[model samples]
Each structure stands twice: as structure tokens, then as C-alpha cells.
Target: MNRLRFAPIPAGLPATVPFTGPETLERRSGAPFRARLGANENGFGPSPRAIRAMADAAAGVWKYGDPDNHDLRHALATHHGIAPENIMLGEGIDGLLGLLVRLTVSPGDRVVTSDGAYPTFNYHVAGFGGQLVKVPYRDDAEDPDALIRAADEVGARLVYLANPDNPMGSWHPGHRIRAMLDNLPEPGLLVLDEAYAEFAPDDAIPRIDPNDDRAIRFRTFSKAYGMAGARIGYAIGPAELIAGFDRIRNHFGINRIAQAGALAALQDQDWLNHIRAEVAAARARIAEIADENGLTALPSATNFVAIDCRRDGAFARALLDALAVRGIFARMPGVAPMDRCIRVSCGPAEELDAFAGALPAALRAIL
Candidate 1:
């Protein structure tokens, strides 16, 4: 270890990007993927209104984004039935999570989460020198009771839970979540990631107060809005806690174009409804394809499916590799038990066709 270090946490931690993006894979192979399905991006894409707004806003790129994120925050407040003071905006949920860690986590602070949860949150915790207490998932779904139990035992200050969770794509009902919150011990702040809530049933999202002092819920425009590149996300929390973000947040982090596009996307509910139908159809197709190839596709509320390879992590990895070799970009969970499945993002019929066509061949090679 270096005697004179600026940030000791980063100095000791491995330098890595949590997720290997599709473009990076393409560059390494010197060939582009046939179907981009690894990242759970909306293949249906943003609404026409959003696209037009972005194009219009693009001309004003010279101006900085609203530091306070006023208009968008107000619009979101109206949409969510909350006060403007209760919200905070950032580049993305990932960025906002980092800020939350930076603000709340001192050296050695304990953070609790599921064993095979969103790795990005773990990455942020590590960066801030927080100790993560991970609990195991119950039957491929994130276990709220188990997580709460671990948090209380550890006397954790923070707990991360992704509703309509990533990778596994399973979620519990709102009542279970509310009960989890009710049982969470004092000062154990909950980081509720609702990135895929738009795709989930309404009952999956808890009806929590916007000013719940013990929780901050995050939402993003990247998934259902199909604007992952825009990097627009926001969090709802207690007014006082939301104000604290002003102290350390990158005020102008969200670009001008992204803000306009997000607002327009929010207005076009019809387009969102259409995308939902498309995602539903694609999910069915994915299940059908998996059944045809003698595989089991887990029921998903998120914009992706985790198909069980009926084997170990190595087998699932081999299947992913086979799919990659066939020019289909896909991914798998990193931790065990959950890692026995490969994640496939929901997309349009054409993209799903590519995945459907590649699955049997990929399986044959791996098997």
C-alpha cells in the first residue's frame, strides 16, 4: 500500500467496469454483434415526441442543463403525486447511488443487499469503503425478510433492494415490500431501485410516502423510455435528504437534450403503453423458444428473462460464450445459484428472432 494515498478505498480496490458493455466486446472481437440483447435496453426505442424534443434540444447544447433540474423535477412531481422538494435528479440511478454512498457511507459503514443483486450498488459501496452484508435470494427472488434480518443483525446503515430486480427478473408484491420497510430498524436507509418498475405489475411497487426518512426510491428513463444513452435518472426521498444531494451532486450532470427528451417521454403515455405490449409479446416468444430447446425461462417482471441452463455456472457461461460466438450479445449473472442462468433482454421480433435462431445452436455447442 502506498504510504501517501489520496483515497485509500480506491487505491486498494481493483480497477474495473462492473459490466462489460456490448461495444467493448465488439471491439475485442473485431466484429459487431448480430443482436444487441445483453444490456436490458428498450429495443422498441423512445417515443417520436421524445425523439423530436431531443433533436430540438440538441441545437441548444451550448447551454448548460438546469442545475436545479427544475422543470423536469416539477413534471415528475406532478406525475408521481409528490412535492418538487421531495425529488433529486442525476445522470442516472448509478450516478445517484454513487452520490448516496458518498454522502452517507463513512469508512467501514455497513451496507446490506442480496447476494446476487445489482453489482453496481456493490461497486459504489466498495468505493466509499462500506462493508457489504449480502443475504441469499430465496428461490431466485430477492428475499426481503432475509435481507431485513441480515441488516438488523449487522446494524447496517444502508440496504439496497431492486424491485422488479435485475438479472433474475423476479419481484415480490407491494405489501411484502411495505412490511419489509416496516420491519427495517432505525437509521437503516433503504435504496429502492425501481428502474424496471414500468414493466412490472402496479402491485409490485409499494405505496410509500415520498418523505419516508428511511428510504430513497430511484427511477430511470433508460429502460422503458429506450434512452439509455441519455443517462437520465431521479430519486424520491425526504425533502431534507433530497436537499443534502445539492451539497455534493453534479448539478449540471444531466445534459440539456436528455432532460427535454425525458419530459417528452413522460408526456407520451400512449407510446409507453405500446412498448409494454411489445415487451410482453417478446417475453412470451423468449419463453416459447426456451421451451422448444428444453430450457426453463424464469417468469420475469423486468425487461429481461433469465433462462435456466439446467446446469452450473460454467455451463451457463459456456452457453453465453456459444451465443457470443454466433454473433449474439447476451450476459449471465456473476454470483452462483443465480449464475446458473443466462440473461436475455426483451427486444423487438427481429432481435428476438436472432436470439431464437441462435439458442439451439448455442446449446448444442455448449452441451
Candidate 2:
């Protein structure tokens, strides 16, 4: 019997997801996590206004979301002081990245990123048959110089960087990022993932020309805005590059509720400021907890903290597993020496108390 055939590209790809959701873990363990802190989601949740917006929009579920995402895109443009033509909305940064990889990468095309950077981006590159070139992180931060050099050396079509980076919770200042972009080789597009930009300092976020075609910056409502479940994000780039996303993106991928929630969330700057303060306090509390456990918490600009277990990756993994068994869900980086640290997201007092209480026992168990 003949079997259905897949395209050569997809047929050769591995069946894998970049992340295993917390719900999947709970199912496998046959228990709920006492503190859900592993996924970097905003446990604080979106603003009451955003919540109300979603509820108000729920009645319109019978109608599809605006395929053009006109209102949200225009709102985002106004928020960023750019023209609507310079923005493109998608399900999330993850979804937008896939579309970007699709638009720019072809079979055997070269792409560059820091080793152990955002794995989802790498996954997309691999799925599209793009050759990935990885530069090692320098001192736990993405080495911009090395990345630029690698892109030039490989004649890469795209390069990826995340400011206030994930897993390790490190960051590069805005000017340095600008220098990296300036030095990027001709024909290479910089994919700057600023999903955590809201949590970063103003100086760390570079000012880019809205009409500049050298880079495309991706932002999401998922992090500081507390709209991860809504699956709404947008990209900022030159009009020409932004227009390319429409060619391949899922036209109606963003639902009405998501668009409403995101729009409402964007309008609530006061709420965003409140969340920022809350996250800052939570980070401090996490650091204090780490100190109590004789661990060092790295300084973070994002909503999560990476606590150095002060040992090898094996030790960190053992401790992370011990915490999981105790019903406190947390995560560690997938690669070393970053893996020597365990990452915990900022949460309210109650959720963090669960972590603070479980950590000592988890460490003792690992020892």
C-alpha cells in the first residue's frame, strides 16, 4: 500500500516542541503544582480593564477577528510612535518568528544566533531547513560582537538576539545592540526578540528607525502585559519588511478576544506601571529567598530571576527535580553554564511563599 507523502523538508524534521507546558507536566505527574512558576507567565495576570475588554468582546465570538488586525496594529503604532504600515500583528512572538523564518529562510540558507538562546527560533530555522550558526554566550550575555562576526563569516540571512534575555536573565544595553546592527553584514536581517522589553530599562532598549530595514523587532503582550494566554504580539520594522509578513502569516490567527484584551492592555499604562513595581518587588523577594538558601540570584531586568545553584548543571537539575517533586514547579536553562542556575518567575507573595518554603528542603534533599 502506498502511504501519503510529506514534503522533503518537513519529512526530514524531528517531531519536537520548544517547550513542554506546565499543564502537560501536571498530567504526567498526576498532580497540580503548588506554585506554577516555571513558564515565565505573568502570574499577576492582565489588568482588570483588559479582562473586562475580553469579557465584553466574548459576545462577538460568532464573528471572526479582523483579518487585518487594523485596530490593534494602529493602536500599537500609536503606542510606539510609528506608522501603522510599520507594524504587523501575529498570534505571539513565537508565531511571528515562524512566519519570519518562513519569509526569509530557504533550504540551506544560513542564520545566526547565540548558542543556547531562544530555542523556538532555532526550531523554526531547522524546520525551514536553514543552516544554524551559533555563537557562544560571553559571560552569560549574548555576545553581540561574536554574533555579528559569525553572520558576516557565514553570509547569514538572519541573526537572532533577545534583549534582557531568557533562561540566564542577562541583557545588553541599547547602544551596544545598535553597534551590533550597524556592523551586521550586508543582506543579513537582525531578528531582535524583545519579548521582555517592558521589563528592561529604557537605556537597554535601543531606539531604531521605524523605516530602517536592517532589523525587525518582536514584542508581545505575554510578559509584562500579562496576556500570554491571549496569544497576541506584533513586529516593528520598515514598511517593506512588515508588509512581507502579510504574505505568509495566518490571516485570522489572532482572535477577537485577544485583540480586545491586547488593545485594552496597551491602553492601560498606569496598570503597566503597577505591574512593573510588583515585578520588581517580587524579584527582590526571589533574590532574598536565594540568599537565605545560600544561592546567588542574578540581576534580572525581566520578570524572572535566575538563581545560581553554586554548582554544576547536574546539581541544579537535581535541585529542580526535587522542587518539582515537592509540587513547586520551576525551570533551569537547557545548556550550561547557564544551566547551573534555576529560573523562577515573579509572582505574588502566596505563590512565592510556596517556593521559599520548598526551596530549603529541595536543596537538602539534593545534597
Total backbone collisions for each predicted model? 0, 0
* Best of the candidates, lDDT: 2
Model 1, TM vs. native: 0.98
- The predictions' CA RMSDs to the true structure, in order, are 1.3, 0.9
Cα lDDT for residue 296, candidate 1: 93
| Candidate 2: 10-residue stretch with minimal lDDT | 1-10
C-alpha local distance difference test of each model: 0.92, 0.93
Tens-digit lDDT track of model 1 for 1-367: 5767767678879878899889988998889988898999998999999999999998899999999888999999999999999999999899999999999999899999998899999999999999999999989999998989988998988999999989899998999889988999977998999999999999999999998888999999999989999999999999999999999988878899999999999999999999999999889888998999999999999889999988999999999989998889999988889999999999888888998899899998867
Segments in model 2 whose C-alpha atoms lie over 4 Å from true places: none
Encode model 2's per-residue lDDT on 1-367: one tens digit a residue.
Answer: 2488788999898888788888998998999999989989999999999999999999999999999999888888888999999999998999999999999999999999988899999999999999999999888888999999999999999999999899778899999999988899988999999999999999999999978889999999999999999999989999998899888888978889999999999999999999999999999999999999999999999999999988999999899889999898899988888888999999988999999999999999989
TM-score of 2: 0.98
Model 1 / residue 168 / CA error / Å: 0.5
What's the CA error at residue 340 for candidate 2, in Å?
Answer: 0.5
* lDDT score, candidate 2, position 212: 83
